[model samples]
Target: MASVKVMRMKLGSEGLDVSAQGLGCMSLTPYYDQPKPEPDRIALIHVAADLGVTYLDTSDIYDNHTNEMLIGKALKGGVRQKVEVATKFGVSFENGREVQGDPAYVRAACEASLKRLDIDCIDLYYQHRIDPRVPIEVTMGELKKLIEEGKIKYIGLCEASASTIRKAHAVHPITAVQLEWSLWARDGEAEIIPTCRELGIGIVAYSPLGRGFLSAGSKFSENPYEDYSVLSLPRFQPENSPDLVTAFKRVSRITQAKGCTPLQLALAWVHHQGNDVCLIPGTTQIENLIENIGALSVKLTPEEMVKLESIASADNVKCSRYISSRATGESSCTPPPSSWKAALKRIFFYG
Candidate 1:
């Protein structure tokens, strides 16, 4: 019912057209903190659909697969086809934490997700995290088999490095790679962006708003959610305060000049990057979802872009988006080596 700009893109060359601005479904259910009521969560998704958001991002690991079941329940009847469903697998939850990737484990995970989703074919299936024990080739090999069996329409990877992305793409065309890319956290630009661009893989920029730091209400003392705050992590701490808000301030100045909210400006920057890039900023509050949806309407200019990059670069915000040695299974092959110990000291303290 609400009027907003809509951009459609092909899932790789799969011929499937999905909304340029997708909804990140994880926040509505859990993984950020306390879980919302299931019925209320489903209704929120339907609310998003009515708002013109057509691509949804979810994962099997979130709430231990409760997220997918929430999605399936929300999109009952003909609502399923109203949006493009994207979910990830691979992370194993044994003792209340993420375990390494295993090829056999991934296969079973996919089947289980399929059963829970109640869909014969997944719109986009991703390896939630890369398994060091199982080479990309082997994991991709299994994913390729799923594609052959018509279990998944497109294959994707999350938090994968450039080389890993390429190797997986070589085995089977990777339609998309989901990663945390925002003004505050931008490790992806180092190598992942070029690799994805060269390979023609779509970039799903999750947390494009810097996890709400760009929003007008965000502040050092304020938590984005009751229990969730990207800044609450060890990286976005007060120690790295200067770098933490530098990019947001730059965006603020630019957006104020354009007569738009900083949140709109941040989302607009992501939208303006290129056709290949899509942003998925999630929130449970309906008002916030509407505010995020309005980002599609804000447009950035080349001059503003230059200023933003300049200010962001000046700050040199040092922080690992994930907790130390935590992002092990998916983004990197091994744990953070001792060489990173120096960089760790420069990290912003949150939580």
Candidate 2:
């Protein structure tokens, strides 16, 4: 395989530098599809690292912690030192699924992630989801303590609202805000992106390929109705799939004219958003990983970006980004701190 050195950029003003494109490890498990052999997945990670793709994104909730373990095993024998390991917490599975961002849970989750990744300090740690019951201050307070204790280097939040992000940053400078932003998912552009830019927080875009829809179009799933994950997403339903597929086809025609694949065009669109925006597009296959890296070379001119945007604008895209009732994007704000004294005590004792 030819070596490709991906460009690097600073995630936020906090001095953390990573590849402009990162490898999202969610699909390495059986979340989206059946799992590939462990060795093959590990080799994919190795190849990504050898190609200078060193930012690895994973979460504790993925496959009940198996995904982090896989990344841990892959990073053994000095590979860990070359990469920045970013894993998330806050989505709790105990006592049924729930989001936990209280000081105690935050500390416990970070400790568990550190143990699983087998790393003394995480390069970047994110709260996978916001817990509405907990104040943003309370969650950020615990993460601040983790930074002080050398457990985590930088802080990030996934699917956080603009207000939540600002409040969290007030508690401690948020290094990055991870949200689902792509040609089809433009909800964040209206507010979250500007807020992050205003606060000097970097943006990490997940699902930049529209959960594989932009890449495969109507063929995203051979059996869309039967695929549990695909069915769970409202956009992949029969009604919405046709319109989305039509928009994708129009975009595909443009990519063909640009001499690139639809996947590259989708990713390149996100990359063109700005230098502060980093994209983590996950893939289970080595060929797909290599293809994702190719997006780095597919530069888009201003006119090309505008033309692509017109084809798959948010208005043209169908259905909500997710079908779940979980807090997402602008809806991720949390309640205000009820009592500052009580919250501080928890931070003090927990810290």
Candidate 3:
């Protein structure tokens, strides 16, 4: 197969240039299923970098830091110079999963990520989840300090509300806002997307393929419970499985006419979102990664975009994206600094 040349885009008005299509490294871990061997995963990363898919995204919480360690090993021997590494902090699993954004925690997390990635500085550092107990301002304050100390080049936030994004951007220019945006996940479009555009902040779209549902379709329903990790999601539950199957069939029909796989069409839909938007579609297989990169070649007319939107509109997709009470979205808003201590107490006692 011929290597697809990836185009570049600026993440924000701050002038951080990265490949428009990035590699989400979560799947390289065991989040979806048992991870592939270390050699295979590392080779996938090298292939991604070689193909110009250089915006590699990972997080500290992914498989308890193993994902970052894997990336570190892959970037050895000067491969680091060819890619832009983006990893996130917050959302600790130390004691049954907690979201932390305290200034102290933020500083410590940045230091730990720096050490684990074996890099002097991270290209783009993001807070994986908003800490409702801590003010967005407080989190951004510490992240800004990291930038000054040369620990991270740019700042980003994931699953943050429009209000929280605006407040955080005030502390320092937020280069990107990472969110779950896909054909089925259009909740961000109603508010968060406009907010990012209004502030000139680029969007780093995670789970752009709807957690692989748009790709695998009804096949996920088969032995869904075999993988307890995904079974916990409402979208994959027995009650909603039929709806997902129906939706995928509709999307598959369009792909047939376009002469592309459902995965390519799904990713192409995201690619058509805008130049300011970058989508990270994760895959462990080399073929899938190549197919994802091939999305750049699949073009859609305006009418086709509208047709696809109607098929997987948020209303059409039943069940919430996640079952976690802490699942953040465009509506996620943090409390003020004055109530930070009180919120922490509630979380400790109730949760």
Candidate 4:
């Protein structure tokens, strides 16, 4: 394998520079499944840092905080300074519900993440999801306080709508907006992504490979509880799986011709978006990590980019527990939520 030299990306004009690509560390610990042995996972992080992949992403809600701890353990042996650690707060997966953006909890969550991470100051901290019930200004206010206290170096938001990203940027210069952007998921492009670009904020695309659908030589499973499962996301339900296959075929034609995997093409497309765009693809195996790093080498032609973009829309990901439970003999996927405010409250607060 050749030495990987990744480009650098600036998170807007905020001066938060990260590797042009990142390693999403969520899969190394849990949530994706039972993690690989601790030493193996730690070795993967070391390898990634050695390969010039520095931007690391995690969230407090991932695997009950074990994800951050794993990174903390890996970075202890003089590897901490080599990587930029970015973790998220504001959403509690405790007992499966609770969107916490209250000022007090924000403070508490930051403290907890810092402790678990064993790091003095986080390179980037993000609000996992906005609590629509709470005003964006209020949450931004808390984040601003953390910055002033020198607990976090940069601030970001995830899964935020375009209007919400703009409003949040008003309170503080959001270094980046973390959202899922891949050939299969282009919701951000319609509004959220452009909003970030317009404001000069950077975009950190998570799940850049379309939740494993674009990965080469890897079997994808649609069941969340099964082995190979990637589900837990409403997008991977049975009804949506076929379209994922079709989308894969569309991209494979180009990858196969280029001697690259669909995953590499998907990642290169994200990079081709602009210097402001970065991708964080997660995996538990070192081979896949190297494969992800190899994506940086696959430069696409203008025609290739156009082809990928033309077939990028792989059906909208819209399914609710309400719809699923209502399905008697067969299941149906609906269009993206038109007015999800009410449904949002029901989901985060009730269920």
Candidate 5:
């Protein structure tokens, strides 16, 4: 058997070492809408770590804390010391639907996560979603305290704007900023990448495979009932939309022509974005996890990079990534004019 591959990067001035590619644990526990059994989820995580995946991501709200507990179980027996465990707090579910984040709530949330994970300190603790109700500084202040208390070794923010990132960095050195960045979602490249570079903060990209669309498998289609898939996005909708299918096909054609899987192409693209950028595409299957980790070896030549850029630009991607309203709630880009055509996208993400 091939040895597990290791991908590593440094977080800003802190110089904390992290994986070049990580695992997102949310899907393992069914944070999206459904639930995967704890045994299966824990087994999958152990397989990732056994395969040399060092960076693992989870959030407090996932399966209402089940994800963390699952990870804690898997990390016992010294497995925790062998890898980096990154988890997020903040963004609570109210009425079983809405997510709320407040500064006070953030402080309390971190403590709750620490207890559940059963760790002396978190390798990296992130603010899962920006709480618009509180200033970025106030929210960051709570994180800074955690770091001071040795509860967290590093701080990160997910799905935050460049401006918010700047404010948070001023409060304390932000080691990494997690964002959704894939071939299908390029909004973060515009301003977010530049900001991270300027501040010396590392970029940790989630959904680097376009949530499996870029992989060498079935295309993303909708089930009016299966809310968790890409089809729920306004852009993926077959109506009132620009030609997303055409673009996806174009991506397929380009990657196929390159003699590589779309997932490999997409991951290579993310890796090429910058030296400080890292990717964390999650998968439950051991084969898929191994395949994604193999992306570290798929280097793209300068000419090939140009080819991909040209094809993607020519495709003129259309549609909103998340539900139109939530899309605006936490991004730098403007939603499409027809965003109102869709309702809150329901992705049946059960881990």
Candidate 6:
């Protein structure tokens, strides 16, 4: 196997730098399916580091805090200095669900994450989900306090709207904005992406493989999401899967020609979008982890990029964020007019 050497990218103009692509640690716990043994998970992280994957993303709500602990344990034996670990603090269990971004809750949540991760300071800290109840400034204000106290080195937001992004940035320089960004989910390109570009906030493309849908295609009878019940989600349903597969055929032609998998094709497109973008593709298996990093080797020509753009147009992406898993509901992700007249989008995220 060729040695992997992942480069680094700067997050906005905040002087923050991290690995070009990050390892999404969400699947290390049972939230995805069956959790791996503690030793296996730690070994995977170590292997990822050896492969030059040093930017790790985790959240407090992932398996009720086990994900952060998993990363922390892997970073032990003086390994923490070798990598940059990013974690979130906005979401906490409340009333049997998530309540996030409150000022008081923000302070408390950061403290709890710090204790769990067994770290003195988090390299990157994000508000997992915006709390509609609080103003953007209020949330950013609390994040600013954390920065002042040296708790977190940089601030990031997940699933934020353009207006909210501007308001929050006015309070403090946001280092990055993360969203479900992939060929299958291009809604963010309409507004949030442009806004991030304007504000110099880096784009962290989470689920860049469309929750494994864009990556797996129809090759496997076993539902990759079987453990998480992602099959129950509208976008992953049998009816929608056909549209996704058809939309990907054009890109599939390119991947076949290049001898790459759909996963690498999707990741290279994200990497080429701009310097402002980075991706966190997650996997539970070591082989898949190495496969994802292969994306770094698949470069697209200008014409190939244009072909990908047409394939990823709003019209081609056929599903919405959270359409009712039931058949009666309609899909919201169908492409809008050349103008972005789509309904005002609110961040609809669950843990």
lDDT of each: 0.73, 0.82, 0.83, 0.78, 0.73, 0.79
Q: Can you tell me which runs of candidate 6 are displaced by over 4 Å? A: 220-229, 324-351
Clashing pairs for predicted structure model 1, backbone only = 130-330, 232-351, 237-349
Model 5 lDDT per residue over 319-344, tens place? 55665435456422343455333424
Task: Quote the lDDT for 76 in model 3.
Answer: 99
Error of 4 at 151 (Å): 0.7
Counted clashes in each candidate structure: 3, 0, 0, 0, 18, 1
lDDT score, residue 72, model 3? 93
Q: What digit string (tens of lDDT, one per residue) describes model 4 on residues 296-328?
A: 889888998888877765443334333332226
Candidate 6, clashing residue pairs? 314-335
Residues 146-241 of candidate 3 have per-residue lDDT tens digits of 899999999998888899999999999999999888998887897999999999999998888887777777466454445433444545566666
lDDT computed for candidate 4:
0.78
Q: Is candidate 4 or candidate 6 better by lDDT?
A: 6
Which runs in model 2 stand beyond 4 Å of their true positions?
Answer: 2-4, 218-229, 324-351
Candidate 5, after superposition: displacement of residue 260 in Å?
2.5
Judging by lDDT, tell me the better candidate of 3 and 4. 3
| Top candidate, metric lDDT | 3
TM-score of 6: 0.88
Clashes of 4: 0
| TM-scores, each model vs. reference | 0.86, 0.89, 0.89, 0.86, 0.86, 0.88
Deviation (Å) of 243 in candidate 2: 1.7
Between candidates 1 and 5, the lDDT winner: 1
Ranked by TM-score, the better of candidates 3 and 4 is 3
- TM-score attained by model 2: 0.89
* Sliding window of 10 residues with minimal summed lDDT for model 4: 318-327
Q: Each model's RMSD to truth, in Å? A: 5.3, 7.6, 6.2, 5.3, 4.2, 5.6
